[model samples]
Target: MPLPTGPVIGIMMDNLKKRKSVFPISGRKAVKWSQKLEIPVGGETVLYTGSMYQLLPYMIAAVNRMGKMEDSFLGQYVGLGRFFNKMFNVSSIMFRPKRADHKRFRRIIRDIARLLQQAGVDFGYLYKKELYAGALAFDLGVDETFVAHAQRLSNLFKAQGVRSLITIDPHTTNVLRSVYPTIIDGFDIEVKSYLEVLAENDTLRPINKVEGEITIHDSCVYARYEDVVEQPRQLLRRAGYTVKEPKNNRNLTHCCGGPIESLFPSMAHQIGGKRVQQLKDAQGKGVATMCPICMATLQQAANGDLEIDDIASFLAKAFCPPGANDKSAEEKRSQP
Candidate 1:
């Protein structure tokens, strides 16, 4: 028996309301760390959207959940979910071992900072004052909460004297760039992806060469919707790595199985696996992903067969090579 998408969506909504994340336990820990570091947990962006576009996954899931779904794992998971929901009034939506990890979270943040430093970009963190962009809520069709949250974020930026934002992920980049201006009146905040900022400037030269082909996985939000297709590739090329394209690349790229992961874990895995296979077929030793969700999904799908990293990490290694002196890296940044 296939579980209806409505129920799955309902369950996710319930979980989001209570757990505040599809990956509840991990989300909570990420949130705690975000507070501790004074940086926003990049994934918490869902708590702030009213866009129907963001709800398309649910609509598609609803249609798919109607019959025997394609993936056996998802079918079994859904079956277990129905049993729990019916018997105990408990939903199996909040799965454990969430994609978000505290260590990785910190690493991503630091990687971006290092990437910027290597690029000769002078930037400062809002530190304890940064708020989650509420991307997930916006994606899940919880517009009212998203709007309120957006207003709060806007106010925070103003209060903190933030003139510009350098976002790490596509989700945060999309919400802050495409969504914020429309909802928040008189929105004057300048939002740019860190990749975009680096690409626009030529000051960051790659001193260390990274050898071999690195497959690039474009985030849907980053590529098609936001048209951030070239920035990462430009950075990658500058870093001295040959960029390879899979069957699906750029605007036509396949989903990493992330957007639908929370609602259909097995299906998400299936999609991610297929995409990873496609990248592998391209014969790249490693894959480079720009989005946090894409990085997580593709890495899960790779299962150790291929190396995967966020583009920031790739750039960090290229500019700040492992064996290089930290003082030299800093001195390079300080040069005219």
Candidate 2:
């Protein structure tokens, strides 16, 4: 059952009113004019349906945990998040595990645990106002559009025999797979961050004949919202590039100001500009990012002062060893 081209708002409201659901429903096209957006694994940016609150459960638990903690630590986490956009991947900063003040990391783990537990108790959470209202009561909120789109995605993927999903970006992954299932029906899908997939595959290659050093910017969605890290650096080393350290990396990775462009423009630009300068400071020759949103931001901010690219783009430029196959590794990289 492929999701509808875009969410059927009428159907959604009807479902809401009736408290019944047609699982794995699709939505109408998000953008009109026969348009599509590119996403990994062949997702064509078509709207899909899922549990009303696949990501809600985590939001709920996290808010509760954070509320029980000191306010200063939470504020500091925000500041550190922006500060960490430089060197390490978002996962490094957010999941450092060693950082004393990383309440979000702890809270995120707890939240996941709670959601998983809830799934065992109930079938799964359904999309509902109760979920949102519950979060708001706790002073937590998420986007309405995202929830709508995510529901369509969960239903779409499930129909495709994808009981487990590896989300490349944290925001989408968490919202679509984590919270909604908790709220809607508690889907049995296994959700893991994309970096974990790469690491699990052990794709890290040895550093060899490499171009000069480069710095990588981890997307906040993966680091903060989702918690992906390390895989990109491993890929860099495998691709024969030396990595440069930036002021901030990992958990504290700076937001590319994407998707959030509606919320803050100048702030995102400032963050991207600062990230580029850090690369220059380290004398790295180029900038690498795992997320397309970050790639666009760095390019706009770098303004061609530096080479900005996504990890996939870089992998496609394989600097192969001499006497390799007649078809150069670069050629093979190009093939895929």
Q: Each candidate's TM vs. the true structure?
A: 0.73, 0.50
Choose the strongest candidate by lDDT: 1
* Winner by TM-score: 1
**What is candidate 2's lDDT per residue for 214-312, written digit by digit as tens?**
787777767676666676677667667788867677888766655432123445567767777876676777777765446555665777677765554
lDDT of every model, 2 decimals: 0.65, 0.43
In model 2, what is the error at residue 219, expressed in angstroms? 1.8
lDDT of model number 1: 0.65
lDDT tens readout by residue for model 1, 1-336? 334555566554444444443323332333332233223323221112111122222333332343235344565465456446544435323322212233444455566666676666766654334456768778878787678778888887777666777777788888998999999998877788888888998888877767788889889998888999998999899889999999999999989988876566667778989998999998886889887678766776777677887787788778764643222433223211
How displaced is residue 40 in candidate 1, in Å?
A: 15
Q: Which stretches of candidate 2 lie over 4 Å from their true place?
A: 1-148, 202-210, 319-336
Q: Which ten residues in a row have the lowest lDDT in candidate 1?
A: 44-53
